[model samples]
Target: MTRIAVRHLGPPRLTAGLDGAARLDWDAHRRVHPEPRPLTAARLVALAEEGRLHGRGGAAFPFARKARAVLDAARRRGRPVVVVNGTEGEPGSAKDKVLLCRAPHLVLDGATLAATALGATEIVLGVTDETAAESMERALAERGLDGRARVVRLPERFITGESGALIRGINGRRPVPPGRKVRASTKGVGGMPTLLSNAETYAQLAVLAGLGPRRYGSVGTPGEPGTVLLTVTGSARFPAVVETPAGAPLGHLLDLCGTRAGEGVLVGGYHGAWIPGDAAVGTRLSREGLAAVGGTLGAGIVMPLGRGTCPLGECARVVRYLAAESAGQCGPCRLGLPDLAGALAALAEGRDAAAACETVRRSARMAERRGACAHPDGTARFVLSALEVFAADAARHVDGGGCGRPVLGVLPADTDARLRLEVDWSRCDGHGLCADVLRGLVRMDEYGYPVIPGEPVPARLEDDARRAVARCPGLALRLVPRAQRGS
Candidate 1:
């Protein structure tokens, strides 16, 4: 693999001292910041409109529209606050972490420029990881921005990365979102309207500021110009961050990463779908391109599943992991994920195929769009995509005892380990005390032990989940906060 220096300030570098350096080398860098021009509000809006810069935070909302919303709302309700969201809690995805650790100054440049344009004074760099927080802090200090921006290390839970949840965490509350629809751009930290976006999006803004609309429009497709950073993991030779022009061919990327001949490629991270290796023949790496293949450029994570690992087994492992990560806020996700995990386990162990498939389908339908957060929906997406991409494997598992391959466990263990609530099957009896305490979070299975969901507990329901944790009969259930859990 290539040993490239992953600096956040500019292009690839060799000096390790430049890892957290603050000097903005405008002329040396390639795409992110080709020049040192300050991006004004009008210029930014124009560039956003021209480049069609979409939010890289999975939602894919138009950047121009979001800016306008914040601008309009700020005009009506005084000034706004710029929030650079570095709280990347998604498992199996490390693009944000890579950017924050390597090129923090680029991200800060974007945040500062955006704040300047929006006429905002205060800036909050919301991060989940300690290393990222330190890197960003160092970058800020290097630029003498101690009082201008504050770096807040948020709870590293999956749901805590949600816009509302991050806002709540910044406001000195647990990193869980309220049940209501609260837009951060309207009422955020300190009751000030906040313009929040992913760390990479801000870095892109810095790039746009440096390279104007027309020059920036010259690299990628007509609509979405510039390059996107992708974390290519699973089965690829070089499992690192790759910078590719938007709308670049998927095949080319796979070749660059030395992806072995595989069954399919998982696009858009865990929440993303899979496409047949042949189907990705001419696929481009853009929102429209991914949409054409029934996928998305979600946070730009692409993983190639090789032929050695049992696809069905890997799917089961991922589904179980996703179920365990649920916040346990809504009834559908909290009650349904464990059942779904059980069904998947059965299928992976060569059980009833029809029953397993039905369970997965039903669980996905129930979980999708039914949670306070998108965790359930994303989990469902992962499961459904597995069903679509590995149909043959599912069929094989149904007929034979197994797929004749090992599990390999390539998805990600951090999320699974963090989210899993171990139950000693040999423990006394099915008291169902945990279920009684944490209503929506834990439900009594046939053998009890309170099967919990994979999503994060909603802000309002956290107290109840905690109560269940406290009242576990066998002391089997433990709420492992991400920080305590060492994620």
Candidate 2:
């Protein structure tokens, strides 16, 4: 795994003095950031509530409310299991990994505090990257907390980072969101209620515990107090994770990265919406602030699109990637994502302009709110926002072929080149079950054989699509996870 460079702006709360350094040991970490003050479960909840602290994770859920629920559930069931979700699945986001790698001790401090508050002893730190896992393990050992805290290397899938999915993976299940609505807080690992928050959430908790609510609330917006770590990538000269105060202007961050906002910026990751760069300059980086500008600071990711790259092409490529990253569970996500991706690709390639846009709009409408997880909704938001934000470029695509620009491929498509879906031709008996179940993806060829899309099956339809495969008389359908051929 490649090492991500870390940096910070303003007084760094989570990433102070750790920038330019590889890893901060327990001693070094303590030297910089003060030790977390002990807090009872009630006190921690009170502090979080007072500070208006939100989860650094994309959902931006109230940390206090989530923690209180876990505590309540744990009291009723069994000791709660505290999980540090270091499985940073967002391709464009690197702040979690930065914390896990550079400030593992800080993250551990927060996790241990939360665990102690809930009277739980075990800390299960979930990391996707092997290096991050090792860093966490070493941190635990260095702090003599290795026995209490265990690091589990999890599957590095997009959906696996979801709280439920992380719990499911830790419980030795496939790293996918549950089909039904099973709250991890109520029924989590080992049938016990779990306290699962991402690595950044724990780190922020540590910061809050150390600084106290009043001091912690000094920097950021009134609604969302404290700083946020952002993985500033794309078009930026130095694409490092920078800790910035909440509600900072988008332009200030752009200036720090030495990136001029060209077409627009993709705030949040691929699941996030796109907004006009000029208009985004004044947009605040907080969740509420960005929401005011019709965008979200999801996962605290900001990617600028310089004029060198074709906006349509870049959007199409990322949409294709999002389609491939689908969990492949529900019908709408499976069929709708690829349809939307295809429409975007068509628009990018300057083909079937009007029809492609129409298909994209229709697919977005169909895909939104149709999946068990938020993948479909998030991806739909991304694509739909692109159409609205880049209206001029979209019109050019619809009216003519394109803006006559090449796909610089600024956005990462490395995962897209990894895996795809395939069919066992000999096993297929033309039962047409898969075609019927996955009509959005699978169709019957002239010979009654199921025709799977050449591209990877959108992950959103994995569950139902798998059911269709199971019902196949010949067991012909299989979703290939890793890439077998070049994208």
> Model-by-model lDDT, in order?
0.73, 0.82
lDDT of 1 by residue, 26-120 (tens): 22233434435666678777777877788888898888888888888888888899998888776656767766766777787778888888899
TM-score of each: 0.83, 0.88
Q: Candidate 1: where is the Cα deviation over 4 Å? A: 1-35, 416-487
lDDT of 2 by residue, 1-487 (tens): 5766676668888888686568899888889887877888889899889988788888888889888888889778988889888898877888998888888998998998988888885999988888898898899899998678798898777887987788889999888778887887888878888888888999998988888888998999898889999998988898989889998888898888888878789998888989888888888888878888789888888999888778888888777777767676777666788678767787887777888888888999898887989989998898889888889988988888888888887887556243355667766778898878875456565577765655555545567667886788887666566546522
Best by lDDT: 2
**TM-score for predicted model 1 compared with the true structure:** 0.83
| Location of the lowest summed lDDT over 10 successive residues in candidate 2 | 413-422
CA RMSD per model (angstroms): 5.4, 4.7
Cα misplacement distance, residue 396 of candidate 2 (Å):
1.1
- Deviation from native of the Cα of residue 100 in model 1, angstroms: 1.7
